[model samples]
Target: MATDFWASTHYKRWIVDRATLRQARADDLLYIDDPEHLAFLAIYFAEVVGKLGKKLRLPQRAIATATVFFRRFYLKNSYCETDPFIVIAACCYVAAKAEECPAHIKNVVSDARQIFCHEPYNIKHFPSDNSKLAEMEFYLVDDLECDLTVFHPYRTLLALCKSGNGSEDASAQEEEAGEVGAGIPADDGPRYWGTGQGQLELPPNGLQTAWFIVNDTYRSELCLLYPPHLIAIAALYLTCVFHPATHETVSAVLAASSSAPASSSASTTPDPPPRRSSRQAAERKKPAQDPLEFLAELNVSLPLIATIAQEIISMYTLWDRYKEDSGSVATPDSSRNGEDDGPVVTPALLTVVLMKMREARLLEIAHPSSGRPVAVNKMLERTQAAG
Candidate 1:
């Protein structure tokens, strides 16, 4: 795996522009008119990945990787071309290997059957044979171009928080020592967020909140459009905005930190530094830096971060309007089951669209003169039959 994202296949080949991503989905959009329908499906499947990963005892990193794989596969292929249930299982199986925590193929298929066989899906067509999942894994890898190394935002978020905390400690020490012009140099680049800017203090739940935001971004096309680090920063930016540090919040954070357990080796270590007087401590204390200002000073493209943030916000809006029970799209005013509101998209509606896509695909295969692009899996099957 490439350590640097700049040199990784994710940055080079997978980071698509918005217009290009839209164009890529044009074929699928022909069958499913409302693009939000697709977004809803993506969100639904992401949750499926999470649930299955949890059941398998897979790490969050592997779960995230599986979700990305599922999304990437659909970017190139239509939903009707292949069974999404099989793809979901295949993605999990492949991601486990990619993350060096492989799950048994039998276990993956069994768990996936349990998920898709109930509720809104009630999918009876799910393949019972383990070989079906094994076969789909080949197509999945082919679609991904063997680019299995996905860099998630979790690590980047932690790194950012760590650097911010380190900078705050250094700033306080420098203030106490009466150092002149003491801080990260301007030439230190984007690695450190506290360079020249004031110190950043994350709220008590800021990092945790940012983590959830990052997980949600996978539901949108932001993962395919922007780099992981930018998405992480955008998540952190949203966290700071949503959970700003008030006096009470800060006091709670201080209290929690003070009550944390000391290191086990503390008794063996020497710590004889003279305690600072309360007056001296008060003089060294500095006001927490505004996270927004700190982020603004970083050497990154603000416009890109803003765009990513907007995309995440849009995802949340879609999630709000989604209803898993309804099979068809409903108008806002249409009341169902005594409910005043209706969903914009539903699994039933997506199922109808997929059925149309499948019917169209059958017709195209029967009449090759239609000139529509054949799904890769179909072409492979045709080749095998010819042989």
Candidate 2:
């Protein structure tokens, strides 16, 4: 795989537009009701993968990569056609390999079986058969088209924060706390690099907050819609809006925005202007600038970044609602057939997927010719025993 993100298959083949994404979601609606349901299930699946990774003591990047793998797999295949729980389990195994943290298939299956013990139907989801997980691995790999390298925003954000201009040098701090003004020379600010001191640097926690924000963005389509660096910029922009120490920076930038639109667009850079000839373009292409200067010159859309921030924000809001409304407690003995009759504290997304899995398993048992479905005979024996 090409290590360069710009030239990678992720950027060229996987980064998709919204309308196309909407159509894909529509196709998956056989199992999911609407866009809201799809997003809710995505959040649940991410949590499942994360919790599994945490239990295994895997790094957060590994968990994040597994989550991305799960999402990418569903983008191509319907969740109903295949068992999401199994796919999620397989993703953790494959992601462990992809991230240089190999996990044995048996251990992965064992962890998942214990993790999802509260599965509604008790259909023995996350089967212990190592072969099942190994077989699912093939499907996951094929559906993902063997593109495993995920470019995240974490490194990009770190690079921006470490730059001298991006963060103020120690010597400049003593000049003035927050009242100093630095002006652009005749040719500086958005096209020209400025040596002045007025540029804003993020607070101590700004980088950390931006990192979390980028992590949360994976719950949505931001990873597939925008490049990693732009997502980092959006996180930084949101940090400026929310973090008390960085408020003044956003205020200053907004105040500056009234005069020109440069800073607002820093989060979403536009393409370079067209050139007459390849030779002329090669000759005129400017040398890369430091991160700060690049930020200043970027032609990003302020509104687009704002929209991305809002998407992350909305996911959190939904998360809170799901937790509050569902109480989010799991019970192994809870009724498996349908809703719990009363206030319905169980999350609908979880409920829906569980029901679908239960139904698919029943269909397989009723029609046993369907190539060794997860324990059809055992499930039938249970029904006979219960009856």
Candidate 3:
């Protein structure tokens, strides 16, 4: 991991242009008739990867990084060109190592096979051999250009909490709530709340919701669009707009935690406050500014932050409608459901992918000579057998 994000490989190479990303995705769009379905497929694959990582007891950092790896891989190479499951497995294997909590190739393969063995997806017998996983790992690394370190918003959120900007007063919050109307606008753009500037404090409930929004932002292109700290600010800002709470909530919670240790059975004893050090007293004497005040001072654009927040909101909206089988209407918590929410990985989709892979393989094998395309039924049979 680079000490300076601006000087790191993530900043130098991975932050891609929108047009460039769009052009790269064009290849995948060609094969996938319904682009929306393909997006759902990517989301499904990310969920599986996350689950696989968790079952192995890896940290959320590793899982989140692995999910980003999977998304980045598909961005460069289409699902039809390579197997999604193998790529997912490889990403998990590499991300575990990258995040300093390594998982062996054998463990990755076995755990993955065990997890998805009876799942709805066509994956019955995935790559169990360590050698196979290692090979796919090489491909994943190459696709990401060996940029393994990913800067997540987890640390940024923690920094905000420590800075005291993670909680806000009720009067300040209510005013914000009234201005924005809702978190995001019903139309395409974001509605600017009074002067489009404020102290930018998030209450405990708002902070928690912001944390959820940050997690959900991983499912969108915001990670690629902006820096980690900016994303954190955006999530908190959106939380305050959509669901505003007061700083007293967090203060009360902290007070409860501190007071709980003194009393037996934790009854309301109105625990006495502890004596503060001179340094602590001095620190408190200074005025507290917005935790994200530094962000405002920097060259960061408020409009860009708002746009990133809007995009994440849009992704959640799509996620609600992503489930084809359930036909459930989208609620705010729709994404909290299990993997069965979206469209299942149909054999037909796999078959199409298999046919494309076969064609590419044939082209590689018969470089000097021409050969006819393989039959669909035989190709499907071969794909199933390989799995």
Candidate 4:
């Protein structure tokens, strides 16, 4: 019944140290082949959700939270363990629930199946007549160890922006009255430290503001350590910086948006891109030169497709750390963000997280063949229910 992130079952298991996960990622053979592949899958998945989130006009935070969920799950598990489409929908479903978006399972699944079936990653091998979702859900739980609490960076950004407005005015009065230090924590206080040596810049604005917000939140371990608000700012900021041209517009819009009280846009967003265009997801996005390329464009790091390939190898490293810390082996560290919360580790949660992950050395493989009757519909149901 308690929901503290640190006290949650997730905190006990899913989080990992970044440096440690990196070592495994570097040394492991599976991830060595294609780390980019995996990272991009996350980016691609986020893009799909982003479009839908935007269409529905949901708060950027909700969509960002969902994307973070997708990324964390994959970071902890693998693609084949359960269908990615299902995983993505699950993230949205969970995010919707967490954010109190009220998304139903049937709608999420039916919409996701329809979108994926028509667009990129045109997966035709899904099961057509099974509660494939239950199986996959079990797998997801297994891999993630049932840990589901997720934090993001967006909340920090809002707080910073809101507080900054007040602090800025206060500081303005300080300058007029006579420069004097207020009750601010010099180290983690409300000072706008900039790139220069000692000069304080104006309160962060435009794209840079987003970056600072993200960076600070990331450092807090929110993604794995703190909360999604931290990461949301990062993603939003990164999006702005990379696409400065568009970011300029985004900043202006967001600035105005920030002024309004927080509200969840309840209207259903546009559908995900059709599955027929799966292969073409790379080509369809029109991107900016360099920065924009990596920031917004899904294929910004296409060459890193191997990251996805490395899931198998890097995963072990996570499992090893988890096994050492928790004195167990079935579940692994969900991220290197290092907040300390591990996966749920309950049989039910573990069953959902680890559904598709299997080493080549392991026996009993389903092989994801065509006409598999995937449990996509049911997956949607559970996702909504769980959320």
Candidate 5:
């Protein structure tokens, strides 16, 4: 289950200093202030996640899952941790075997240098040294409290959107809308969000996750604080207003209504606010359920989740087309059903995998049919035939 960011090391040690957060305001990095950046990072690193998975030969789902974990962690905590660069790289390491995307520490470090390296910031400090990452790993584990599982809005949102024999109705739509980006309860006491909430605004994808965090909370079915749809809308509004998402993305959604359903509601709507990302960028946008929350089941299913964790391990290998030659499962899958078990591969999971890939620009969302069921490509070589 996805936990609060405040309780994370990100909240405690990593709040991005306000000065630093704004430092790029006057430079080329001004886009850092735009919300598109959040989408940008999630998309970008998702590629890294996939590449790492391939190099290590792990599953596509595991790679996508780890990327989401890294993105969510940064949303609440400022980027002021010992070395966020290190943490980002380390997260892939921690999420690897757990998510079943295994890689040698040496290889992980090597790839980190090759792909994610920024020109000025020496990549060496970013998880290359075993000693360094080991230290940060402990910090990450401590901050996250070994709570490494993350729930993604992709599948949750997709399920909510795709239910009912491939068509949706208003009531069903409302239910799907509630699946992601619910309202965030201010933490005055338990501070489940970690020590990072009161800190500066989150990182690029921080608010994106913020949108998810709030909504996932609502999906718990334990509260009436607000409807999940309301939370999704508001969170997207807030995220688009304040962070890397620009008015462009926000307005695009609004403008899109014209070509869409042409509901009476669309005609009465006001123009969205003027915000940042490239105007052309909005025109290129594709439809995604706002806040994209579809994994509401995690809120109340820890027992089932324990089993899913094991399944994640096998799937990671199945996708990578590389695994132990010995053919033993990295972690065993449930054998109780007298059924053939495979990685946790499903259409919903595939959507998240695809969303991450599209965001990373590795693949373009040209036509709806243009998209590939990449989840299968990476994992279908599930096993070799008997010798």
Candidate 6:
């Protein structure tokens, strides 16, 4: 397995541009009118994979790897060309082995069936034969080009946290100088980092919230569009934004720093420099650095981060409007029933779109004289055969 993500196939072969990703999905999009429908299906399947992973008792790493595999497969091929239910099972099986936490093929199939049998899915087409999953695993590996080693954002998030906390000595000095919480609103108390003293700390649930965000990224094309580290940074950024304490602390620090020069110049006669301890002197020169500051210092593309952030925000909007049984737009509350726990895209809807894709392929295959590109026709035939 490649420990360095930069040298791995994931970075070299898997990271794709948005245009390339969109072009790859052009064929599938023809069958499904709304592009957001693809996102809805992705989220629904990601959750399904998560549930199956839990049932199999696989670790988070394995589950994450499985979700990536499922997404990567779809990037190369459409749901119409393959049954996503079997693909989900295959991904779980393959990811387990790749992560060195293998699960039994039979157990994966059984667990997947149980999950598909429920509410929105009501899927009766899931293959009962464990061999089908095993067979699909071969196709999945081929589609993935055997790049089974997946580096996730979780490790990167942890590393960033540790590095952020390493600045505690400096942060403590700022706390002593009464500069740590300067300019912060009264309501924005130090809920996460402890009265703005010591190191930058995530709120009680900040790390978990970021982890969930990272998990949710798999539901979008982020895994394919950006590197794992960038995704980790984006997740951390969102975590800080969502948590008032962390967000305010960073904002206050930046706001204070930006206004420092103006405030110092406005004074007619500045007070003499105070005689103070070395710690205080150091604090005077360097204020407490929050996670946001740490993020800003990193050598990364801010635009890319902004783009990923926007993509995630867009996904949230799509998730809120997604419904299992309908293609029409509806609010989150309207989509849910009293009995249903959450919204899900039914297999029946997926089946309908997939059948259309297959029919189009069949028509293309029959009429070689049609204007459709020969390459597309052959590709469709190959996908149809693989299915």
lDDT of 4 by residue, 184-270 (tens): 123532232112132111233433355444533321223453223223333443445444554565565566556555443443576
Best by TM-score: 1
| Strongest candidate by lDDT | 1
TM-score for all predictions? 0.75, 0.67, 0.65, 0.43, 0.33, 0.74
Which lDDT tens digits does candidate 6 get at residues 119-177?
45656667777666766787789889998877777665554463333356435423322
Can you rank all candidates by TM-score, best first?
1, 6, 2, 3, 4, 5
Measured over all alpha carbons after superposition, the RMSD of each candidate to the real structure, in angstroms, is 11.5, 13.6, 13.8, 21.9, 22.7, 10.1
Write out the backbone clash pairs for model 6: none
The TM-score, computed over Cα atoms with residue i paired to residue i, of candidate 5 is: 0.33
RMSD to native, candidate 6: 10.1
Candidate numbers sorted by lDDT from highest down: 1, 6, 2, 3, 4, 5
> Per-residue CA lDDT of candidate 1, range 1-387, in tens?
466666678878888887877776676676565665666777877777888898888877778888889878877876655566677888999988988789999999788888777655666677778777777888789989999888777656655563333556545423322211122233543553535343345755566677779878877778788777788889977785666553345455556556555554356767566567865886788654545566778768888888889888888987876666634343323354444434455555555555566667566766757576654566335322311
**Total clashes, candidate 4?**
91
User: 32, model 1: CA deviation in Å?
Assistant: 2.2
Off by over 4 Å in 6: 163-201, 270-286, 323-387
CA lDDT of every candidate: 0.69, 0.62, 0.61, 0.42, 0.39, 0.68
Worst lDDT run of 10 residues, candidate 1, spans 176-185
Return whichever of 2 and 5 wins on lDDT. Answer: 2
Model 2 shows how many backbone clashes? 3
lDDT per residue as tens, model 5, 123-143: 333444565555556655655
